[model samples]
Target chain A: MAAAWHVRGLVLALLLAAVEGRAEPPEEESPWFVPDHAALQLAGSIGLLSAGPGWGFLRDGVDAELLLGWAPPAVAGEDFLTVTLKGQWHPFRPAWRGWTLRPLTVGLLLSYTFGDAYFVGLPDRYPDGYYWFKTALRPALLLGAGAGRPVPALGLRLQGYAELVATDYRLLHFLQSPATAGTGLFSLALGVRVRF
Target chain B: MDGPLRFAVLGDIQLFLDDGADAVEDLRRRDVDFVVQLGDLTEYGSAQEYAWVAELFDRLPVPSFAVLGNHDVLGTGADIYRRTFGPPFLSFQHAGSRFVLFDSNSREYAFPGNVPDLEALGEALAPEPGVDHRFTFSHVPPWNGDFDAALTGPLEQLQAERGVSASFHAHLHQFESEVRRGVPYFVADSLEHRNYLVVAVDGPVVRVERVFY
Candidate 1:
């Protein structure tokens, strides 16, 4: 529990720093390594909470993020550490009353968990082709929409989004046993994205 | 003579939790001595799913045991299985018969071939003075590709030498019964099939009947 709280505090601090950084005079030709945005997410199979730095491209319609996620033993029954690389595309963005609404967003992510318990390859105990799936790596698809408004005074944009996530395991089970496992095909994740 | 010692056997319950629940309810009414479930208890081996299955098992009136399956070993699932169901390899005597449950999902371990732990099986299958019959339970049958190919023959031979009355397995999601190397092997249908097996033991006589609920 303490660990989860610590992560929460860190996320808050990062967000505050990102917002504060936006108020400074823009750097002349900022380095490519500098982050353009940050995100904080709740649930969706990564963990109880996840936060990350993100970059935008393609006219601010395509976004990529690197996230660090943790779930404490108290909430998840075991402590889990996950790092995810996510890519998203928003094809349509409309402006309404000073707000930009992205009605459609499609994304994909691959998350790798850090722990001995999760394996990318079969342990020496088993021969090759024993099990088809890798436990440590998980791939998922996301569909969602978002709405953001520019805060001119702060030189930032605050966006709120909701996503429906379909993980590989969930998709496989849903296809195999639609009658029983269909309802669990998608898990919901809510998040806030801040752009500077 | 308590008539015949009767026990129930169930197969994979993966993604069919509701059906599994119905089967458990049916088993409760059958008055069996105990129940053995072939694994694949959950679709993804998540802790939440383990808790759900454990809760369902808790509702059974008779003692029950679960075998470890391939799906149950995914991502920390092996640890959760150990915590939720105790050791994957276990042995106990009940009603003059010896029951040995072991991990046999060799493919999940990438086929290093020690999954069934033949050495441990040898110890468990060792003859006991008062034991009238011996039965073995595991998730994968020796005939399946998921079972270790190199150990299949040796495993069958060991069971035959040990005089195992019947070897029970689940993983194919179907039912099959055949004799391999002079030992009988039975594969129970998955819970989604709405069927289970009942084995009655009388001294040296054993009878297996498939029950559909």
Candidate 2:
């Protein structure tokens, strides 16, 4: 428990450092200065918390992101930390009439999880497989589309987006299915992007 | 063609490799159609485990299909799975019915369209003029928020609208069956418990039974 807390603290510190480094950009008109976004997400079917930092950068019609996330190990479970390196390419750079109708983003992600209890089921649930953790590294792809309006006052950008991961493959695998060879669950993220 | 299409539904075999082998042995006595494993076939989705399950699943006299669970997505295990089992989501017609399988583990990756891809499922479930029943298979249940929040109500409504006979899912690791919107959602138990779901589709009637061995 203590070690998990320490790791959490370390991840938080790293996230803070990343945020501070974004304070100044090489160009004033660049999107590199866009502030980081943090969210408290309701993880999957399990009543667990998924909180993390999302960083974005725009350069020459392309948006790149680095998402550092942690799913605090559920009660009596270990912590799960993942670093995702993702980059998105938008076909149309900016909005033509306060509306960015032709914006398409394609993302590539490399994610890694550090922990022993990857999918530990509740004890009262599966008595046969009571307490077992499956942990390892994972690499996934995301193809998404987003349309958003810039909020200059609050330094936030509200965007509605959808992404598809691992669809090109021969099979579709979620992280919680018996057919899933590994932790390949699909996620749908609906949130806002903030810039300060 | 007049006989029932028999298949087995197993869930979250996870790291219980030995237990899964046991399940395979138990299945020897029962000769049926294909076998449908709900999801979580491996603990880490490792190639070794995938090989083990693949080999064991091959022992059956029928074709086998599986959905990907959270545990099976770790590392390159998912990739291994695609290499081994074909695809994560599968659709096939057997015994005058359509079987639509999909992924519903929401928190694993970015927006995955719809975990169960109800739109696709709905199209597949659309009254096939001549088909008798439609069955849907997925890893997570709509009741579990891990599924696409926006699609849950609509999915249940679609199932009811199309009169889907049953929707099978795992991941909860328990034995449960409930009717949501007139469609039965069956959550099978894990393999460690030495159990599997048997679906007998004969002509226009479909029967789902849980058996332990």
Candidate 3:
């Protein structure tokens, strides 16, 4: 439990340091690897909590992020460590009363879990094509919306968002047994993103 | 004659909770002494799914047993299976017949070659004072590639030599039955097919009937 808190604190500190460092210049003028934003998310199948830095492209309309996620054994019945790479496109950003509302966002993510229990490749036991899917890697589709406003005092743009995530396991089960798993196809995730 | 011993055999219920529930409802109306499930009980091997399936099994009117399937070993599923339904290998006597349920998902264990522990099975197959016949159950058939190749012939020969009446398995999601050597093998269809096998053991004779609901 203490280790989980420490990890969370470390992630927050890193995010804060990145935001403070971004005050120097415009992102385009800065190095390409410099992150423009950081995000902390809760519960979207990646883990119970995930945090990471993000880079924006195409005039801030598209974003790509790499997140490290963890699910504590206390909550998940087992500890789960996952690394996720996500790409999102926000097509519409409407500003109203100093608030920017991105009402539509579509994204995709590929997450790989670290554990001996899961396997990316089939073991030597069976012949080829025994099982169709890999247990270690998961792919998911995301639909979300965000609302944000610039906070000049903090030198950041604070945004709050909610996403509907549909993972491959859920999708396949929904297709195979719609009556039992239809409503559970999509899980909700809530997060906050700080753009520098 | 003491009459025939009646039992039920059902197949994989992976991700099909409603179908499994329906089959249980149908089984409740039958006069079977016990039920044997052919594994793949859950899709993702999640705790919730295991609990759901266990609850469904609890609704049955008689004793029940479950074999561990490849899907049931995913993630923390193997632990959940052990906790929910005891060990994967089990042997018991009901009426005059001795029934053995063992793990045949050799590939799931990365081909440890001890999955269908022949030693334990050999011990379980030994003749007892009052037992009239023997039956074996597993998730995967020995003929399937998922089963360990080296143990297939030996296991079949052992069963035949011991005068085993029949063997049952499920994983293909389809029904198939054949005789290998001198022993009969039956594979039940998945619950989604709305069918199951009803086996009646009469002294030395075994009758298997495929019933569709």
DockQ, each predicted model: 0.28, 0.03, 0.36
What stretches of model 1 exceed 4 Å from their correct place? A1-34, A56-63, A72-79, A87-107, A114-136, A143-155, A160-162, A178-183, B1-3, B15-22, B25-29, B48-52, B55-61, B110-114, B143-158, B191-194
- Tens-digit lDDT track of model 2 for B91-159: 788767788888787656543656667677777777776678888888888888567677789889998
Judge candidate 2 at residue A179 and give its lDDT.
50
Model 3 TM = 0.81
Error of 1 at B84 (Å): 2.2
Q: Which is the better candidate, 1 or 2, if ranked by DockQ? A: 1
Candidate with better lDDT, 1 vs 2: 1
Rank candidates by lDDT, best first: 3, 1, 2
Model 2: CA > 4 A from native: A1-196, B110-113
Name the better of 2 and 3 by lDDT.
3
Number of the top-ranking candidate, with DockQ as the measure: 3
Clashing pairs in 1: A125-B112, A126-B109, A126-B110, A126-B111, A126-B112, A127-B110, A127-B111, A127-B112
Question: Each model's TM-score?
Answer: 0.75, 0.54, 0.81
Isolated chain A: TM-score per model?
Answer: 0.85, 0.57, 0.85
Model 3 C-alpha lDDT per residue in residues A1-196, reported as the tens digit of each score: 4366446545655764675476447644777678878889999988899988888899779989888788898655677778789998999998999999989999999998777676799767657877687877889999999999999999889999899998987777777766666567788989988987
User: Candidate 1 vs candidate 2: which has greater TM-score?
Assistant: 1
